[model samples]
Every structure is written in structure tokens, then in C-alpha cells.
Target: MSVINRVLRDLDQRQQQQSKGSYTPAAMAPQPLHWTWMIGIAVGTAVVIVILLNLYWWLTIDTDPALQVVEAPVTNQPTVIAATAEESADQAVEEVERGTDAESASKPALQRGPVKPRELVQVPPSPTESRTSELEEAEATTEPVVSEIPTETLATVAPEPEAEVEATDTPSTFAVERVQLSPNELAETNLQKARSALRRGEREQGQELLEKALTVMPEHVAVRSELAAYWYGRGFATRAVAILQQGLDRVPQQSQWQLLLGRILERMGRIEDAYIALQSVDSSSAEYIDLLEVRGNAANQLGYFSEAAQDFLALASLKSEGRWWLAAAVAFEDAGEPAAALRAYRQAAFARDLGVDARRYAEDRLQALGGS
Candidate 1:
């Protein structure tokens, strides 16, 4: 019985020792990995991936400047393009001219129309007509080439200014049709023709041309003067008067015309009419001296002694001649102004250029007026 009990005790002791060796404490047990270690591992993996990608890109990229592409610079100007187009058009025109010359040489039998010059074309082959013919011929031979030109280029090359162009519809080819003469110009031409006719002794033709000139331009001073002189020299005083009056009526501002009219009226004994006509003469006129003399004479004839004296005094101041002073004295005496007449007589009596008869007349007037 003691031996069996001792064997049970040994077996129990062996089991207790085995249980103590297998059992682990909770504080000493192996725990799951921390989240911080997991986060650190993930970040390290991303950094390694980025480094590998950069190394791959560096290895694949090209580093040579020689293989780089180049592009042309851009411009916004339309004139530059137009200049290029003009150069192209010049080349095209030269080619067209060469072809036309070749065709003419090759087919002498082909009756080609005469090639009108592009510079100046007239008559039936008017400038525009010539241009159209040229364009049509050029298009027939080189339509594809010309068609490549821009519409702007075509517009630039086709039309011309009207002044430089000639018309073909009119039957007459007179140069007068091309040029339009102004009224003054026509009158001038007529005046020249009349002078030529007069020189050639063609009286009727000269008269006709002069009349035609006046009809064309009533205010033509040269033409009117020429016609008036022509009649007055031919002893037709009335005709000269009419022509000059007609000119004055059209251009009253013409001082030369006024002077001529006054002279003609005075010559015809129309003193009153002549004085009135001469009143409009400008003081700045080349005919001013002539105007004063004629007006003074006409004034005396019309009993306007004061006006005559004033006109003669102006003439004396300008001419410094004793005859003018004597005339002024006579005018002043007629005007009933003895003081002014005496002063004028004194000037005339001692004048150096006064004629013998004039100086004696002045002295006699001075004595009669109670002056020394």
C-alpha cells in the first residue's frame, strides 16, 4: 500500500511541473505588430517607388540640342504678303509674254489680233478692251497659273484710272475729245486764231473768230480788247463801243475793260457816260493815270468842275507835269474856286516842263485871278 501511494505522488508531481512550464503570463505574451511600424514601412515603400520612377525617366530622356525642332516666326502684316504677291504677278506676266511670243512665232498662219501695247491703248482697242483681250489670251493659255493668284492681286492689276484711259465709241479721233478745254482756254485759242487770220489778211475770218471768242466767254478780257481794237482801228467806233460795253456788263470788276469803255465813250462825245463808266476804275490799276485824264476831261465836259479839278490835281501829283497843273487850274477856275485855281496857276507858271504857250497861258490866268 505505501508503494502505490508513493507512485501516485510522483506522477502528480510530474504533471505539476509540466503545467508550470507550458503556461505563459499575459504581460509577457508576444503582441500583434504596432500600427506605427506598419505606417513607417508603407512610407519607406512609396519613397523607394518614386526614386525608381525618377531613375527610369532620366534614362529615357534625350539630351542633344542638335535633334531639337525649329519653327518659323509669325508676322501680322498684309503688305508683306502683297509684296510677295506682286513679285509672283511680275513673274507670271513675263511668262505669259514669252508664251505669246512663242505662239506667234510657231503659228504664223494663225491670224492673231494685233497685240495692243499695255501702256497706252486707244481707238477700238481701248485701254480696257486691250486689257480684256490680253487677260483673255493669258487665261486661255495659263488659266491654272493665273487662277492661283488671289482676288486681291487680280483687282490690283486689272483696272486703271479713267484719266489715263481712252474711249473707242466715238467716230471722230480729234485730240479735242480727249482734253476738255475751259471757257477761258477756248477763248484764248480763238483769240490766237483771230490774230493769225488778221496777219494773213483774212478780215472776214478774223472777225468771225473774234465774235466766236466773245460768244464762248463774254468775260475774256484779252479777247474783248482784241476785238474792240480791231473795230476801232477799222473806223467802226460804234462797234468797238458795243463790244466793250458788252464786256463791262459781264465783268464789271474788270478795271481794264472799264478804262477801255470810258475811252471809247469819250471818243464818241459821250462825256457824261464816259465819266460814269470811268468812276469804277481801280486806283491800283495800270490804267489809273489814263483813267484820271479821261475822267477829268469828261468831268469838264459835264460841268463837274470840282470833280474835274480833283481828278487833274491827282494827275498832277502823280505826273509832276505843268500841263496837268494848268489843266487843274482851268478846272478849279471853272468850279468857281479862285484860291485853289491860283495855287494851281502858280505851280504851272514856274514849272520846268511847261510848254511856252502853256506857261504864258498860266501866267495870264494868274494875273487875271489877282495873283503875282
Candidate 2:
């Protein structure tokens, strides 16, 4: 057989064999179906579907319900809080008003009508009271009165009018007496007279008399004070201060000497020392009242206003007349106490019959201070 016929014959034999028993068509073949693999595939597909369903639920489900519980609205909160706060405030205000009303109601009532006095009624004593009074009288009357005989007193006695007694005036023991000075005091008096002469510009005679008086009593405080005054009149403050200080040392308790020293120190511009000397005087001493006045004036000039005010207040308490009130007003004003100054000025104006001026000044100051 030729090669082509042989090949065709083998292909027909294979087809015949294929058409015999145990042969299957392509669309209806008894292929070896892998049950395990199909089952595994179905299970995998089911797992994937289930996973996708779970993922969709997880991704799309609403979680607002869970959050809503934590963030819920507070119902009726504002209205309730406002009502409670308003009620508390009203209660507090009502309490305050009640307190004020109670205070106002408790004030003393004024008289609305004329007052009638109570009538006095006298009652007679009871029997027990009369008996007790009689018992007390009986116990008190221990002495008996004696009676004169009527026959002996038969003669009539003429009655005489009583004489009037006249009061006599007696002289007061405190009347000023002419006191004779001792030799030393007289000499010191002469020295003061001479110093006065010098102060009056009689220099030659004053120097002569002072020299004579100094020869007599060299250690007299009056003489020394007068000499210091003379030096002060001559404008020798240092010498005046030294002499006055010596006199003060001799008579430490003498207000006149201290006043002189203080004056000299003040004139010399020794303010602190002057104040010290002036403050040594006792305010209650009648002897130093004049000296305290001088000190107050000096303090005023020195601008020691608080000190001046204190001194003026003391003088005011003494009821001093003339310039005391004026001094007090100036001192108070300089001390930065405008209210007290105004009061002092008012008192001064009233005292000095300058009421209109004082009132105007005080009113102006008060207005400047936004009114009292």
C-alpha cells in the first residue's frame, strides 16, 4: 500500500474503535468529575460571599444610635435654671428689703398730741400705819416740858421790835500787794531798765547803767536775759543766744527765759533748736500761756504746721480771745486738714464778727472738694 492509503486506513480503524463501547461524546462525556475540588470551590465562593456581606454591613451600618445615648439633650434645663436663679435673687432682695423695713419701723414715734400730767391723789393713813407712827412718836419723846406758875407770870411783859442786822464788807486778802524786791532783784530790775533804755536807742545811758548794775549783781538771770535782749536788739544773735542760754541754765523752769532763748534761736534760723526750747514749756501752766502763744506764732512762721496746729488747739481750749481762732484756722489749713480748717475758720469768723467772709471761704473750699 502506498503511504497515503496506509495512513487513511489507520485513521478509519481508530474512528471505528472510538465508536464502539466505552466511547463518550465531547458534550456528554463521563469525565472524571473532581467532587472534592468542586466542593472546595463552592465552599470558597460561599466564604467570599459571606465575607463580602459582613464587610458591607460593617462599612454601612449606622453608629449614631450608640453616640446619641452619650450626647442626649438636657430637656427643660434653661427654663428650670433660670427660674431657680430668679427665685433665689428675689428671695435675697426680699430679705434685704425686709431688714430695711424692720429697721425703719422700729424708730421712735413722735408726739402727735399734747401730753397730760397724771393727777395726784392723797389717801388717809390706815389704822395699822397710825398705830406704828404713834409708837415711834412715843419712843422719840423722852424729855418732858416744864410749865411756869401762872401767879408769878401775872405781870404783863412789853414786846420789843427786833433790830435789823447790817452786813459789813470785808477786804479780799488776794488784793495786789506792793512787793519790795531784794537787793539783788532790785539791781536786776535796774539792769532790765537799762536794757530797755538801750532797746529804746538810748545807747550811752543804757550802757552806763548796765555796767553799774552788772558790777553789783553779776549772776542775775533777769540781768542776763535783759543783756541778751540788748545784744539781740544790736543784731548780735550769736551773743544773744549764748547769754539767753546761760540765763535759761540759771533758771531752767522760767518760761520767760526759755521764751527769750527760743526767740533768739528762731531769729537765728535755728528752727529745730527753737522748737525744742519752746516745747519745754508746760501748756497747763498759767505762767507759760503767753510763752506758748509766742511759740505757736513762731511755729507758724517756720511752717511747722502740725506743731502750730497743736499749739493753737491748746490755746483755743483755753478760750483765748483776739487772734487765737485766726491762728487756729491758719494752722489747720497749713496742716492739710481742709475740713478742720474750714471749721476753725467758721469759728474764727463767728468770734470776730466776720461771718460772711468765713462762710464764703468755707463754702468755696467745700465746693472745690466736691461738697462735704
Candidate 3:
């Protein structure tokens, strides 16, 4: 029995040893980390950072209602009235070196607001009133001003006083000293820098440079126009008007400056002043079309639809845009000239530059007036 037990145990041990020897464990190998996936993750992170930075830069200049311009006031700049003719001469020399165009009329994207028809005062005074003085007669003989805007609109356009502001306190921190610096060169450099900054979307920096330029040369027409254009594009027509008005003080007969001022006044619904400014422009000037547009807008705002229609028709003759024709047709309709309106509408429908909505308007007007 002892011999049989030993034999059975040996048989079991031999079988276990055979199984262990046959199944030699394969050597374990470590799997490599996915470097390609890690690279993809790093690239995606970089792209996200770039996008975030760009968005931040763009939003920095956004004039949200909650944000206000909080620039530090420059303490050392000379008063605009105190600015000497020598400084102006220096700036003019600088501009000449830079080859800046004196008549550069590059307009920015204009800001627009609601302009409703206002009641006009009488143009001619009644002779039977009383034995008034000559002064009274002259005052009464002045052309009627278009100034019956709603109270709310008037309130929104207040706070201009630009020349007053310049004379009292300049708005920026980087002030220039009249006696301590390289006058014209400094101003030119600043203006060039301002243009560069604006092109790069650095609005505040550009604005600061412009303020510096104006400090050195308050009546610098190009600098004033550029600065005014910036404000005008930002919906501050009063600010633009004030700046340009200051420019007009220096060069009262400057046609380009007057044209821009007229355009701004029209946008502000100062129809009478705008019309007068437009009338001052020569008909043979290069800006004839712009003058027409400005005069037409002013006339339209003052409820002179017949005059507006005539101006628009002249504008249509200059440029074959459907929008102009459409505007002319609407003005004609307002003037109670259905035939003229229908002719303009038909012309508008066939223009290649015709917008979908403008086309629809022309068709509808034509249908209503019983025209093809």
C-alpha cells in the first residue's frame, strides 16, 4: 500500500512539472506612449490661445454702453488759442516733408441717426409787422433754419463744444511741450505712428497719437479730418462737427473741409446749415456728386421732396446705381409726381447693382402707380 501511494504522488508531481516546462511565460513588453496624440493636443491648445487673444484685442475697443473713455488729461499742452503761428508753420513743413495731401477727402464709414421732417420757420419776414429797425430786418431776412428736432434727439446731440474743450483741457495723457521738443518732427512721427496703430486695430493708441498731433497743430486740416472721421464713424457727429468747425476757423474757404462739414451737418439733421455749406461748393469741383448727395439729404429732411427728387435725379445721372434711382423715385412720389416716380422705378428694376429689397420696392411702386 505504501509503495502504491508514493508512485501516485510521483505521477502527479511529474505531470505538474511537464505543464510548467511546456508553457514558458512570454516576455512582457511595455507599450509606447502616443507622441502623435500628444502633439495634436499641444497644437490645439496653442490655436485656442491665439483665438482667445485675438478676440480680446478686438473687444478692447468696443464702445459698449457700460464702458466710458477714461483717458488721463494732459497737463502741459499749450492752449489752442495760445498755439503760435510758428508751431503751425512747423507742422505744415512736416506735412510737406511727408507729402501729405492737403485736399485728401477720404471719408470714413459715416454714422447715421434718425432724421425726421421738422417744421421750418418762414424764409421771408412780413413787411406789415411794425416799424422795426434795420437790425431786426436783417435778422428776420435770414434764411429759415431747420431746427425743430424732437427733444430726445436734441439731447443726444449735445456735449459738442470741441474748440472749447481744446482751449480748456486736452483729453489725452501724452502731452507735448512747445518749448522742450522737436516740434514738427515729433508731430509727424506721432501722426505716422497713429496711422500704423489704427491699421493694426489699436484704436486707443491711434487716438492718442492723433490728440498729440492736434496738440502741436490745432488747425492741421488733415489731422483734424482724420480725428473727426474717427468720431463720426463712431456715431459722434457733434464731435466731428466741432472738430471740423475749428478747422473751418483756420481755412474758412477750404472746399474739402466745407464739404465734409456739410455732410456731417446733414447727418445731424441741421438741414439749413448743411444746404448753405453745400451751396458754397463749386459745381465744377471733383466732389460734385458728394455735394449733390448732401444737399439732397438736407432737402429731404426739410420736407422739400421736389428739390430732393431733382438732386437725386442729378445724382442718378452721375452714377447708375439702383439705390440712387430708388431714392429719386421715392422722393418724386413724395413730391406728388407719379410719372417721374414711375420712370425712375422702372429704371431701378433693370440695374445690375439693384438689391433684392430695392428691386421689390421698385416693382411695388410701379404696380401701385399702374406702370410696367
Choose the strongest candidate by TM-score: 1
Mind sharing the TM-score for model 3?
Answer: 0.39
Poorest 10 consecutive residues by lDDT, candidate 1: 60-69
* Reference-based TM-score, model 1: 0.50
Task: State the lDDT of candidate 2 residue by residue for 1-372, as single tens digits.
Answer: 699999999999988987896677678657896999999999999999998886665433321111112234657433122223345446545544553464347643331223223222112236796576556555555457777757646555433434322222344366788998776977876777786787798987886777567667656766666667777878888888886676666567567678788767776788778877777786555557777777887888778897898788777768655256666777887789877776666566556544566656655655564544
What would the per-residue lDDT of candidate 1 be over residues 24-90, giving only the tens digit for each residue?
Answer: 8778767999999999999999999998886664333222111222343555532122223345446
lDDT of each: 0.79, 0.65, 0.75
Clashes of each: 0, 0, 0
Give, for candidate 3, the lowest lDDT window spanning 10 residues: 116-125
Whole-model lDDT, model 2 = 0.65
Q: So what's the TM-score on candidate 2?
A: 0.41
Error of 1 at 205 (Å): 0.9
Best first by TM-score, ranked:
1, 2, 3
Residue pairs with colliding backbones in model 2 are: none
